[model samples]
Every structure is written in structure tokens, then in C-alpha cells.
Target: MPSPRNWREIPARYRLEAARCRGCGKVVYPARRACPACRGQEFEKTMLSWKGKVVTSTVVQVAPTEFQMEAPYAVAIVETPEGARLMTQVVDCDPGAVQPGMEVALVFRLIRREGHGGILCYGFKAVPAA
Candidate 1:
């Protein structure tokens, strides 16, 4: 059971919420207090488009202990049309097939289970856009 504050702090993990900096018009994901581009404090909430293009990607042959079972996966930096970029796992296809400029759609999925409680963590994963 996550606290309300925990959930509130990460709307982007669940809903793709982002912040548009009023100062520089930069859109940042995982909405932060200050804009990275202009160091602005004012922002307007925005929703990122579910679809994006992979800017870069790599096939993970080695993974941390917690993720070894899911190794040989593809990790990519995806950029939305709004200019928000996020690192996300790419799934539902061959890892070797993922490449830069590939189109993908962000989808809500289980990331992993944590602790003895096996609390399921959920986040977005990118899949090949049909």
C-alpha cells in the first residue's frame, strides 16, 4: 500500500503527466519544481502523447541482480512530439529489433515486484506502434 504522497509525486509513472515550463516552454517529464532549461519555477500541467520515437536504444545483455530474469531486454530513450524524453523498457518484440527512430507507444504495465511483500510496481513500457 503506497502512501498518497508517494502516488501524488509520480503522476507521470501512472498517467504520463508532464510540466511545461512557463519560462522557456520546455516540457519536462516527472514534473519537477524547477525547469531544467530555464530554471523556472512556474509550470503548467500537460499530458504527454502516448506515441513517441526511440531516439536511442540498447539491448541489455547484462542486468542488475533484480532484473537478471528480464535481461536481454531493450532499453531506450524515447522522445515525444512535445519534447519530453523518458527512459523506458521496450517490450513485445525482439530486443535486437529495436532501433533509433522506431515508433513506439507507451503502455501501462507491471515493472517489477519489490521486497518480501512483493509489492507490484507499475510503470510505462514502450511497444512497437502498429
Candidate 2:
């Protein structure tokens, strides 16, 4: 079964929706209730551009129980053109190939299956930008 929190984040996960603080022009991903930069309470909904650059990355050699089969994957903090950064797995390439400053594009993909019932979860993954 999908967690209630995951259900609530569908808008950000599926559409790359972000909140832009009107006061400071700060763009925050996953749509926060308040702006962290300027403590602004008002925001405007904005859609992030699919393309971004890897700000940092790490290769996960040891995986959690759910992701053991996919061990040695690369996870990275990607920054979109709108300046919103989000952590996501880098896919469709060698784990070591992911590097800082590497360009990437967000793509919808199967994230994982939840629980014994195997409820499928979908989310975006970063792939090398064409």
C-alpha cells in the first residue's frame, strides 16, 4: 500500500510542480507551506523545466531491503532551471557515469513496489539529457 504522504505528493512527483516565493523569488520543490529562504508565506505555483544539472551524486553500493536488487545505483541532487533542487536516482547509465555538472532530464518511471501486495509506485528519475 502506498503511504499517505506519497499520495499527497503526487502533484509534485508527476508534474514537477514547485512553489515560488513571491517575496524573494525562491523556488522550492515538493511545494512547501512556507519559503525557507525568506520565510515568505505567499507563493505561486510553478512548473519546473524537465532539464537540470547534477549538483552532487553518490553511488549506493549497499542497498536497503527493497532496493537490494538494484544495488550500486547513483543518486544525485539535481537542480532544475528554475533553481529547485530535488534528490533522485540517476538511471539508464553506469552508476559511476553520473557526475556533478552532468546535465539530466527528469523522466517518469517505476519507483518501486510497496508491501507484500506489490502496489506499484511511480516517480521521476533523472536520465542523461539529450
Candidate 3:
């Protein structure tokens, strides 16, 4: 259920694809043409690990219209083993239970339905690591 502009991002969204800067070794999510840290143009495609730890978390009591049904969910910045941090919703547990330093695993799940037609959108969510 992604927008037309987001259709091109399916690879990164579904597979955790990232671009690593050859000059600075910085990893940028969703891929990029240039490195934000070093301003370097040379990059290599990399895949992020599914395992990570929550660097920060927040409970969302209010959400966008598209996600109204899922209000009061936990959202967090999860840092992967490679040091790539990405924002994702924390699911499959109590929202208030999410905390910084909590171990989590990236999971593929439904994000939301787009528009009135109910086009389904799939992406990654974080769950408490077993």
C-alpha cells in the first residue's frame, strides 16, 4: 500500500537493504547516492542484520489517520549489530514494555492498508527477541 513514489523503495523496505559508504564506512538506510557523513559518492549495497537492540523507544498514543487503528503502539530506533539504526514499530508485545537497550528482532509484517481500497502494505516491525 505504498505510494507511487515509495514503490521504488520496495527492495530496501522489504529486505533491509542499505548503502555503505566506501569512504567512511557509514551505513545509510533505504540506500543513497552519496554518503551523508563523508559526502562520498562511492557506495556498496549491504543488507542489515535482523537482530538489533532498541536504542530508544516511545509509545504513540496518537497516530496518523492511516494508522488510527494501531494507535498506542511502540515505535523505536533499533541499532543493528553493524551499527545501522532504523526507526520501526515495536510489535507483538505490550507497547509500554519496550525500553532502551531491549533486544529485538526485525520481523516482516503488515504495516497498514493504503487508502479506501485497502491496499495492504508490508514492512518490518521489531519484536522482543527470544
Top candidate when judged by lDDT against the true structure:
2
Candidate 1 residues lying further than 4 Å off, grouped into runs, are: 1-9
Per-residue lDDT of 60 in model 2: 99
lDDT of each: 0.92, 0.94, 0.90
TM-score of each: 0.91, 0.96, 0.93
RMSD of 3: 1.3
Per-residue alpha-carbon lDDT of candidate 1 for residues 1-130, written as tens digits (9 for 90 to 100): 5557656755878889999999999999888899999899999999999989999999999998878999899999999999999999999999999999999999999987766778777889999999
**Cα error, candidate 1, residue 106 (Å):** 0.4
* Candidate 1 residue pairs in backbone clash: none
How do the candidates rank by lDDT, highest first? Answer: 2, 1, 3
lDDT of 2 at 3: 88
Q: What is the lDDT of residue 98 in candidate 3?
A: 98
Better of 1 and 2 by lDDT: 2
> For candidate 3, lDDT tens digit of each residue in 1-130?
4488668878888999988999999988867787888999999999999989999999999998877889899999999987888999999899999999999999999887777788888889999999
